[model samples]
Each structure stands twice: as C-alpha cells, then as structure tokens.
Target: MIPDPDEQVLVDVRAPLREMIFPFLETIVITGVLWIVIGWFDAADAGRYGVGPLRLPPEWRNGFVYLWVMLVLWRFVLPLLRKRRRRMVVTDRRIIFRADGFRARPRTLAMSAVTWAEKERGLLAVYLQDSDLPVYYSGLPKIRKIARMINDPLI
Candidate 1:
C-alpha cells in the first residue's frame, strides 16, 4: 500500500524545468529598448566631456550585443534559475524528485529509513509525519493518481 503516515513531505515536480520556455523575442525586445536608452545616455556623457561627436563605439554592434545576451542567458542564467528551483528535498527517510526527462533523477522514498516528513501547502497549513513520506506528482503526466492517493490517504 502507499504509505500514508499522517504526515508526508513532497517537493515541487515542475521545479526541474523551471522557465523551460526561453523568451527569445522578449529578451531581444527588452535588450533593444535598454540599448537605445543607453545610447542616449552615452550621447549626453560625450557632450558633457566635450568629445568630438556622440559617436557610438565601433564594437557596439547590435548583432554582437544580441549574441552576447543570448550566450549569457543560455550558459549562465538558465542553469542558475533551474538550480534555484525546488527540485529535490532531503527527508529523514527518502528523497523526492521527478524521474522524467532525459537528465532527471528518479523519485525514491523508503519508509523504514525515514524518521520524519513535512509537507506545506499555501494557506493549507503543514502536514508532518514521523513514519512515512508522501511521493506525489504535481506537474508531471498521470499525476492525478498520485494526488488522489495523497488526498484520501491510508496507511
């Protein structure tokens, strides 16, 4: 039977793929707007410094800027965001995580090994157990079955 020790803890299932959809268009638009504003500021600074003319830097190519932003986003930003997301939580008895995805780890829980479990839902208070842990899916496919087991649980 699915172990329901009156208090079981689970982690967010969607945490592994947080912000999966990269907003290429959005990033471009925002970056473009910011660049324009920066150009204006550069012109003002040049005037203040008595520079010949407010000539933009030769290396400030739009293509280079866009590529730079995309590179940083793909190489640094995305990984950081995913890392900060709640993927797995350590419990007294087991670890909970999504087993799907080409690189995701499988979810595993052991009742005998667990000494405590805690689950907190917004405005719902918290569920804590000292014997078993709940392994429920939140965003994955076929998550309903697991959710049902949690809603009306049994030992």
Candidate 2:
C-alpha cells in the first residue's frame, strides 16, 4: 500500500549483531560437517563401492577443498547481503519489511492488524519473535520503543 502523504516513520529497526552473526556461525558449522563427510568418503576403501579413489593429486584435493569452502562461504555472504538490504520500518500507520533488492517484495502490516506487541527477552526469543504474518522485527535495537508504537492507541 502507498503511504499517506502525512505518514511518518517512527522507527527503522535493524537486525542486531547476534542475529547477523549467528547465521554465519551456523553456516560455518554446517560446512565443517560437510567437509568431514567428504573426507570420510575420500578415505573410505574403494572396494566398498567397487570403485577406486579419485586419481587427483593431494595438492588438487587441497585446492578443491579450498574452493569448496569458498563456495560454502558464499552461503554466509548472501544472507548478510540480504540482511543489509532488509529493514523493518515502523510508521504511523503500519509496520513494513523493506528489502531493497530486485527480487524482494516489500511487506507491510497495518498496525490495527497486530493483535499484540511485547518485548520478549531471551537468547532465541529475541531472534524469533514474530506476529502471525511473515513480517518481523526481532533482535532489533529500540524494540521496546517499537512495541510501544505498535501497542499505543494514540499513535
């Protein structure tokens, strides 16, 4: 929906450092596990599969692993870039999830549609809070202020 000419933005919420870092850490862990699995397969007896091990030299294996790790790192990079493009904007009339990218479609929830708003505290809670809709502003600084804006009747 188009904003009214008189509409004003009250808060621009962003993902906190913890929210941003966790995904990178998770990606690293997953990629590490994948690397271990690959190593196991490489070391497995060729007789088990009726096929010989890869004929590439040891240096080639190292180079391939390095390239694989770099590719896996891209998984982490994309999320960070996407998060950078994303923003939660609280305005006088609604809450908006804006992603400044060609493939992203902005989402907005009218304030009146929010049944409740609260500042939930906890490690995972901070990162996982959401309304019924897909739009969320968890792990954002000034969360209390944002909640107040959403819950206030006089806004």
Candidate 3:
C-alpha cells in the first residue's frame, strides 16, 4: 500500500542484536571450519587425479582459501550486515520494512491485510519474530505494546 504522507508512525522497530546472534555465530563457525580445512589441505598431500598422493602448489591452496573466505563473506556476512539495517515502521495505514543492502527490497503490509496479531515467546521465538507480517520485531523493548498497537483497530 502507498502510505499516505500524513500517516502517523506508531512504532519503529530495529532488528535487535539477539536477532543477529545466531547468524553471526553460524558465520564464525563455518568460516573457522573452512580455514581449518584449507590449512589441512595445505599441510597434507592427498591422492588425486588417479595418481598417488599429490600436493597442490601453495598459491593454489591460498587462492582456494581466499575464494572460500569471499564466498562466506558474501553468503553470510553481507546478509548479516543488511539484516542489521532492517527496520520496521508501523504507520496508521500500513507497516513498512526497509531492508537496505544486497538483494534489498522494501516490504509493505497494509494494516487492513493483518488478520491477526499475537505476542510470541520461547526458545525459537526470538528468531521467528521478525518474519511474520504486519510488524517485524524481535527481542525488542515494548514489543507487547507494539503488538497491541498493531492489533487494536482504534489505535
């Protein structure tokens, strides 16, 4: 929905640190493993190309490590950075999420489109909170108030 210029913003929610924690941890672990694998490959000679143990040149191994790191950065770190920029603004008529960066797209949900709203909690709730419609917020202060603002028609 095209928001009215006069529409008043009721809530502005930023993606919280808790929302980034899992992806950050995942990136760290995967990158660490890739580094270890690259190191191992550099240190050991492995059978390859139907021949006995073969050792790749140090440059080739280094190149592979560099490529892997780049891949990880693109696949994980870049998205994490973009996610950090995510913000959800709830206006009188609609909810707008501005996700700016790689593959970025703004998402707008008309308040009229929202059929239901509820506060969620539990182990996985923090991660799940951002994806549901109307408002994208997780581990945020006054989340209950935000939910109420979204759900109450009189608001």
Give the total clashing residue pairs for model 1.
Answer: 2
Model 2 weakest lDDT span, ten residues long:
122-131
lDDT of 2 by residue, 1-155 (tens): 34667988777766655556777777778777768756655664343443355443566557657766776667677667766665677777777776634377768777766666666662112121344433344446666777777667456
Best by lDDT: 3
RMSD of each: 9.8, 8.5, 7.9
Q: Which runs of model 3 end up more than 4 angstroms from their true locations?
A: 1-5, 37-55, 81-86, 97-116, 120-142, 151-155
lDDT tens digits, residue span 25-88, model 1: 5556666776776566566556755554766664555565666577668755666554444344
Report the C-alpha lDDT of model 3 over 1-155, residue by residue, as the tens digit: 23578998888776666666776777788778878777667556565334346666677777877877787787777766876776767788887766655565668777766755666762112122335533334445466766777777476
Ranking by TM-score: 3, 2, 1
The candidate maximizing TM-score is 3
Candidate 3 lDDT (Cα, whole model)? Answer: 0.65
Give the Cα-based TM-score of candidate 3 against the true structure.
0.52
The TM-score, computed over Cα atoms with residue i paired to residue i, of candidate 2 is: 0.51
lDDT of 1: 0.47
Q: What ranking emerges by lDDT with the best candidate at the front?
A: 3, 2, 1
